[model samples]
Target: MSPASPTATSAIADGVTDDALKGLRRWNLGLTVLHAAQAVAILVLGNGFAIAVTSTFPEGPPGADAPAPSSLFEVSISVAIAVFLFLAAADHLVTATVGRGLYESDLRGGINRFRWAEYSISATIMIVLIGFYFGITDITAVVAVIGANVAMILFGWLQERVNPPGRTSTTMLPFWFGTVAGLAPWVAIVINLAGSDGAPGFVIGIFASLGLFFSTFAVNQWLQYRQVGPWKSYAFGEKTYLVLSLVAKSALAWQIFGGSLAG
Candidate 1:
């Protein structure tokens, strides 16, 4: 009937937390591998289809009867990226378990800064696909969007739990970026659905969605490193890469949209 000391209570809570995380990690690891395999299979098949379609229909819209690379790549890539994202989510789920259950501190936690880098890069690739889609009308672009969106949501949730912004000026960027990026596509989609097709709604949707995805992705990774200790130590080079990727894609997205309009 003795009252427990605050220190003792904290330790007990930590132990319980650790056990829970361990279970989650085990579950996530298995799921992650499963998702990865599925993604690979899907992408391989989709790419093959793209080759077939491109060869079969080299000019304008496929004759209602002709095969089209556009459709093949679009659908195939979409499925591939979607599967990849599902696999990525397994990382968060697994990492969370590692951080909470296995590691005592941030350094030892399941997801280290490098892991964040990988996630950030993958997210960037997804956003880039959004731009590519505008130009090529292929599955790769669609799948990238799908994968990016899924990763953002899952990782965003993990960020809150494991790397919550601790009232730092620098930390605000990721939260805001993620908030905007995560919401942009949904907003654009709604707007496009309401707007007329010839009104250039698709173009607007593509831009908003891609911009939001990349900007948010950069912010998310920036925030991850910011929490590691000092902002000065954060990876500036990686940020540059992310920024360049976005810039490159933005131009391509615009060009694609322009081509569609001119034709």
Candidate 2:
């Protein structure tokens, strides 16, 4: 019997670590693809249908009494979706390239860049929501939309700075705050829908779908905090957070802008 050499033992440990990194990279890439696809789907389905429906409406009379046609909300939503799709695609393309060979430093850099991008986009969304809120006269709906956007912006800022997965301190504050923030968009959507008069069927359906996504995302955040089921690894946890953040914000934007158009 002989003892294993130090170099050989180190090699074995390194091999295991390398394999783990590869797995994480693959997971990240997959999530990125999913995010991009969701953005495209929203644009194609939502905007396509909107254009088709609006085209059916006859042009208004030239007289001053005729209400001017407004497509501002629709255009705003399309632009938002296009921007998000671009960001997701570009970010993930960089991630897929840099993520190779499983270099931790490079991986971390990419993730941090992605987080900053997310933060910027979230802030932009809040601004857009503020504009939409002011455009409408529904007080309750306005408050809910603004509150939800503010909560999400705070959540994004804190999540990036706090790095909950890497911290040992209690995450109770972030956890509860994130949970509420994630649910806020859905609540706002429901409030809007309830107060809406004669909203189109597809519009109602879109709100319902977004509500479900936000609801699921809120639960997933809580579950990740608890480390129940598959939320154990930092890699898995962060990936979930990224995907949910992208989905929730994008969907919320679509809902808010689309709802405004409906009004």
Candidate 3:
């Protein structure tokens, strides 16, 4: 049998490389959109919150016990933001399922399922936020929101463990750390919502939790760079992860924590 010519071999290699790069580009695009959507949703929500606060209590007496805004227009805006956020989360879930090849295999299927769960939790958080605009202070709603937040962190940890991005070892540090960071705000929210006179402590907890979350990503990125040399070697979604970590998480942390502190 004659061996393959150099031209044919090179052509086959090029085709395979092109296909792989195309797949990477697709994943990168999907993740970029998803991260951008989440960031936008957070910004919109923050804007609505700001509008409600200004319209309601423009003078003073800002705190957890501050009177709920009564302007129909402001409330409607907040509701709209919540709806948009929910839709974004839903869209990302669908895109992730397809782009990430969730159904391509059993392992992929599990990861995709976890991602869907996270997306659903995000949607539920938006719904609860909408209820806040409607002046729904039911303890159950607050608890549900906290529960969903915790669940999302758990799912994130599991996803990282099941499928470590690029080449990383599976460790429980992220899971434990995320649990502590994610739960801090929930605890604070629960305390405030439960009618406790602990607004200051609650505010502190929220701020610290946000700081912790942001710091975790920063540290992770540093570690990755230390180990992986540079951004070029990073995985397809790494850029999105870094951008979202800073943009989305910081926007959320600052908006809620800063607003509460100012109040």
Give a tens-digit lDDT track for model 2, residues 1-263: 11222222111211124455667567657757766776666666554322210121235665435343444224355555556655665666565676353334433322244544554564445434433432332334444555665666566445434432233443447546765665655554556556767666545655555556645645654555566777544455556655766666566656655654333
lDDT of 3 by residue, 1-263 (tens): 11222211111211123344445446545654655565565555444343232234445655546565454333333343434344544444454456445322222211223334543455345434433433344454456555655564564545444433333233455455555645544454455556644445544444445445544544553443344344323342243343543344334434443453232
lDDT value for model 3: 0.42
Model 1, position 52: C-alpha lDDT score: 17
Candidate 3 or 2, higher lDDT = 2
Q: Per-residue CA lDDT of candidate 1, range 109-184, in tens?
A: 2224434544555554454444344342345434444555655645544543343222222234435545655655
Candidate 1 — which pairs collide? 18-101, 73-139, 74-138, 74-139, 78-143
* Highest TM-score scorer: 2
Per-model TM-score versus the true fold:
0.37, 0.55, 0.31
What's the distance in Å from true for residue 135, model 1?
A: 3.5
Ten contiguous residues with the weakest lDDT in model 3:
6-15
* Candidate 1, position 245, lDDT: 37
Candidate 2, which segments miss by more than 4 Å at Cα?
1-17, 27-76, 98-113, 119-153, 156-169, 179-186, 241-263
- lDDT measured at residue 72 in model 3 versus the true structure, 0 to 100: 38
Model 1 misplaced stretches (Cα beyond 4 Å): 1-16, 47-104, 107-115, 136-173, 177-263
Model 2 quality (TM-score): 0.55
* Model 1: worst 10 consecutive residues (lDDT sum): 1-10
- What is candidate 1's TM-score against the reference? 0.37
